[model samples]
Target: MTTAEEIIAHLRSLRNQRNIDGMRRFGIAPTGEQLGIAAPVLRAIAREHRRDHELALALWSSGIHEARGLATLVEDPRQVTRGQAERWVRDCDNWAATDALAFLLDRTPFAEEKAHAWSTRKAEFVKRAAFSIMAGMAVHRKELPDSVFLGFLPVIARESTDERNFVRKAVNWALRQIGKRNARLLGAAIAQGVKIQRLDSRAARWIAADALRELRSRR
Candidate 1:
């Protein structure tokens, strides 16, 4: 068998049904197969096979939760294509996989373009990926100017009424991360959050309230 097949076999061998139950409790139910291995173990495995783009593709095709997470770690961000990112985002079913993929995609060249494009999408996970990319970029892309994130504020406000658990949480995450970036952005983010609170939606209120609390605390 190939190295990818061998690694997948090893992952399956480490499956823990108890851990699977715990993961489900945390809303990480993958639509495909899962071994229920914890993230640290998957990261360790990925470290052993770093920068294996082909292997990452094969593992993603395996449709196992842990393997997909591993793919995010092992794949070369520079080698990732916009088409590939779109395809992977479409396959995401759980927050764990979606967020993991977003983290990887955030490091790619197409991140900013896709983040804006996908944010407007109506699909739950796709939209979640878009904001997840924003959140990841807020933390990771230090060179980006505040204007980029400020531009996203309108998108967050528009989507605040979505009411989907994943989408709302991700929107809040993006707002909070951008706010925490600096003093100036903190004020801007808080102002946006306050505006979001008045939007007449339960999800918007929650996002605004939570972001305000965190942004204020950092002041």
Candidate 2:
């Protein structure tokens, strides 16, 4: 069994001050220890571990930023319980980590339920996690009906008023990804964007414009 401590020790060896600085410059700061490992390298490490759910849980409990990301990569989504998801999501300190968790979370059975649940949160990263899961689902969950995503549009619009950079960007990402799924969704998303544009918020207008730009280009 590959131990979490062993992986963390190896991750310690891979630290680069330059990479850490670069990540901080781009607002990727985590609330805890972060080894300056690039994401590609972490993904490679995850490939080595594969779907070791126990190892993933151990890695996540370590509280190191990159280890949490690696945990998301190597964990078995089938093994993800609602309690585990809730616990891990509270640990997200930055957009990058939030998105990493969201990608893994969207693969789980309770993804849509969580997406709707988290969007109502007041915490910035937590709220952003909702749309992050939604965006991930748009790309990966093809079996889902268009109406599933359609239900998310109102939530996206509601969140568009959040001026937080991370939250609004994720709102735009979800809208854009859902729109790109197919022509039917594209039309609905475009209409939702127009409605979002009508809102009295700078964030809403920006989200509308950015999504509309790319969505229209797809037409």
Candidate 3:
């Protein structure tokens, strides 16, 4: 039987000879833009080791793209640290990797607290990572309070004007998710969406409009 370590080593060996040029042909390359791995292969590798967080961390640090998928496969986010999570978020150069670690795995003990904090970060990817986790958590953890989701409205209201592709998308995603959770929150989200629309920016307008369209309709 291949122990997890042995399996990781084997995977690392394969990475050593990975054809970056060829991978790019298929829209997959070690761009090193965000932890340097393609999305599809990472998902596949994550599926293979869906239960081993320790192994996943080891694999993630290996700097192989597929290992990141495994990191997302980790079921227990508590195993990963805030430091490690932030490091990965900083390393993220693309949406797939940023969301994979932030939304999929790498759960810091202070995830909610950190998400709020990181939302204010200047780095595009890091800020998106924070909000992406907020979106993911809305779906992943149902027990969170209405106050918790309501709190995110201010973040969205402020960030709505960012217009940056990754950041706005994530902020919008978080807003939509909070709205979808229940009727009470839907009303709150709708109000915030209206506030966002009044902001003096195209990005803010779009964010509010799009979020209002969905959140209002559902309620």
Quantify all predictions' global Cα lDDT against the true fold.
Answer: 0.92, 0.95, 0.74
**Candidate 1, poorest ten consecutive residues by summed lDDT:** 1-10
| 1-219 per-residue lDDT for model 1 (tens digits) | 249889998999999999999999999999799888999899888888888899999999988899999999999998898889989999999999999999999988889899899989999999999999999999999999989889888888999899999999999999999998899889999999999999999999999999999999988
Clashes of each: 0, 0, 1
Give the candidate order by descending TM-score. Answer: 2, 1, 3
Candidate 3: residue pairs that collide: 34-93
Q: What is the lDDT of residue 18 in candidate 1?
A: 99
lDDT of 1: 0.92
> Which residue pairs clash within candidate 2?
none
lDDT accuracy of residue 53 in candidate 2: 94
> How well is each residue in 1-219 modelled by candidate 2, as lDDT tens digits?
778999999999999989999999999999899888999999999999988999999999999989999999999999999999999999899999999999999999999999999999999999999999999999999899998899999999988999999999999999999999999999999999999999999999999999999999999
Per-residue lDDT of candidate 3, residues 1-219 (tens digit):
345567566555555334555545554444542233445655666565666766766666766566555666754676666677777777676676677777753245577887888889999888998889889888887767788888888988878889788899899999999889988988888888988889899998888888888887886
Q: Please give the RMSD to the true structure for each candidate, in Å.
A: 1.2, 0.7, 4.0
